[model samples]
Target: MVYRQEIMLTGAGGQGLILASIILADAAVQDDKNVVQTQSYGPEARGGESMAGVILDIDPIYYPRITSPTVLLSMNQQSFNKYIKRAGENCLVIVDSTFVEDVGNQPAYSYPITARTRLELEKEIVANIVALSIVNTMADLVSRQALQESVLKYTPEGSSDLNLQALELGRQLTHSYD
Candidate 1:
């Protein structure tokens, strides 16, 4: 049986974690992979923490909740520290190094994901899309065409080009590791 792949996204609210997860999940669907997504957040929308978990399988995806993710993207220290240990052994951990100084163990890759977006996209929220691009590339999780299509269709209206840059930036970050 073809193995399943799982990915998790975490960060404070307004970082675009939920938006990025939707694109990734949609891309998996386009590839005919079974997909499940779950998210959690605190009381308010702007300042609290948030997270998204996505599970993809070649066969049926029974549960929507992730038991153990194979890939993790964390933009804050709190979410990173909490879930870092729960991820699988071979999992790839991607973090925004500018804000997170303490990511414990398990093979991590750090990038100024949020900071770069603030400069390039002129907005802090677009960082999640940029980070998602890197996650997709590093994991070989989704095709660029699939990503492009989803970004175009799903991004908040009038924010297309900015989102595109986020995806490209994410793609660029993966090269540093290779």
Candidate 2:
């Protein structure tokens, strides 16, 4: 079967979902897949709503927008409530349990992403990297090497070790969920 994925990552503006989307798109490209990414955030910037869309396919992509996401990552309750309506029936729904209190019957995989990042990693900013790794691992979207390379390439210097640890933690968290 032809491989295709429409992924949407949503959260508050400062949560880094846009960066995650970019990293995912970059990883897809590294794996030789055709990919497109787009993002939008509310006026408040840091606290406002934010969403990023990424589409990956083995064949050429005709549309850049995501109408029905095959995978949805919601970092907060507001984004979860707003974007869950657009997910495909079989979409993989993953939510950050730290900020999202409810899933409302949508079979979602929940993780304490922010809590883990803050408590375990001692840095909450890397929560986006955690979330990205979780989504990538759960969805089996790209090779681990490709994803790791993309994460390293996008993350700032001196932060590679923490980001890699965050990625591994995410993978561990996903396994624990199952």
Candidate 3:
């Protein structure tokens, strides 16, 4: 049997959603799964909205876009509002609680990811890494080892440790939600 899953990572520009999507797709490749990754960002580049989509399957994928996601990681209210309604009932919606206030009645795992990245890690730039960790842990979309390797691969040479720490923080955050 063939299985397919779509994942969407959304936030403002400069949040590293595109890099995270690429890393995820690379991990899928390492795991011998077929994956297609795509991204879009607003013109403003910094505060504007950003979205990354990944479609994974055990077989060849005919379509490259994700109309609805099996999982969603929303980092800001705008991205959350834009994509959350399109999510199916079974979607695993993970939101950055600090920036996204209204999650409505939808079953979601909310975490203070940005706050933790800033306060705990003292590196606000690693928030996206934290989100990736949470998504990887909760969705089990790829092997932890593979995801870790991919993280190290995509992260800047001197900053892997911080990103790795953020990843661990993200994993730990999932325990509270579970």
Candidate 4:
């Protein structure tokens, strides 16, 4: 099991990468782990590049930024191109199959995250939560219950069920990664 792990989530500004990172960090914190989260975005709000980094450790965190991530979640082609090359050798590179088509020959997990949300749940905004569920399941970054609780805590009111459904669908999608 990994004691210290670095995770990076990248997408367009409106894709909710920041929220996903927060949820992941919150779950880690709930588990009594030390987690540090940092985010960056381009000048534009919606269409610009967005990135969030989280470092998790059992001991006190000395640094919050991630130079090389062990897990990279790329929600678009641009993010995939920007972060994949810098990922660690065994990095679990996850890409949104619906939006990222240029993953090259990398051994990565590809899923139609937003497509599943739109087609199944009828809402694409919860794609981040879905992606988070996938990450939590595949990487064992956090417990399912903790991740679910963090999702419900961070999710806006009146949409808990929708996000929960998305999270469940994402968990179901984890089989595809194997």
Number of the top candidate by lDDT?
2
lDDT of 4 at 139: 86
Provide the lDDT at 109 for model 3. Answer: 90
Rank candidates, TM-score, best first.
Answer: 2, 3, 4, 1
73, model 4: CA deviation in Å? Answer: 0.3
Worst-scoring 10-residue span by lDDT in model 4: 169-178
Candidate 3: tens digits of C-alpha lDDT, residues 23-101: 9999999999999999888688688989999999998988898987999999999999999988998899999998999
RMSD of 4: 1.3
Clashing pairs in 3: none
lDDT of 2 by residue, 1-178 (tens): 9678999999999988899999999999999999999998878868999999999998898978997899999999999999998987899999999999989888999999999989999999999999999999899998999999999999999999999999999999998866
TM-score, structure 2 vs. true: 0.97
lDDT by residue (tens digit), candidate 1, 75-161: 889888888878777888888987888775556899888777788778877777788888888889877898889988887788887
- For model 1, the stretches where C-alpha displacement exceeds 4 angstroms are none
Local distance difference test, each candidate: 0.84, 0.93, 0.92, 0.91
Provide the clash count, candidate 4.
Answer: 0
Off by more than 4 A, model 3? none
TM of each candidate vs. truth = 0.93, 0.97, 0.96, 0.96
Regions more than 4 Å wrong, model 2: none
Q: Which residue pairs in model 4 clash with each other?
A: none
Model 1 residue 43 CA deviation (Å) reads 2.3
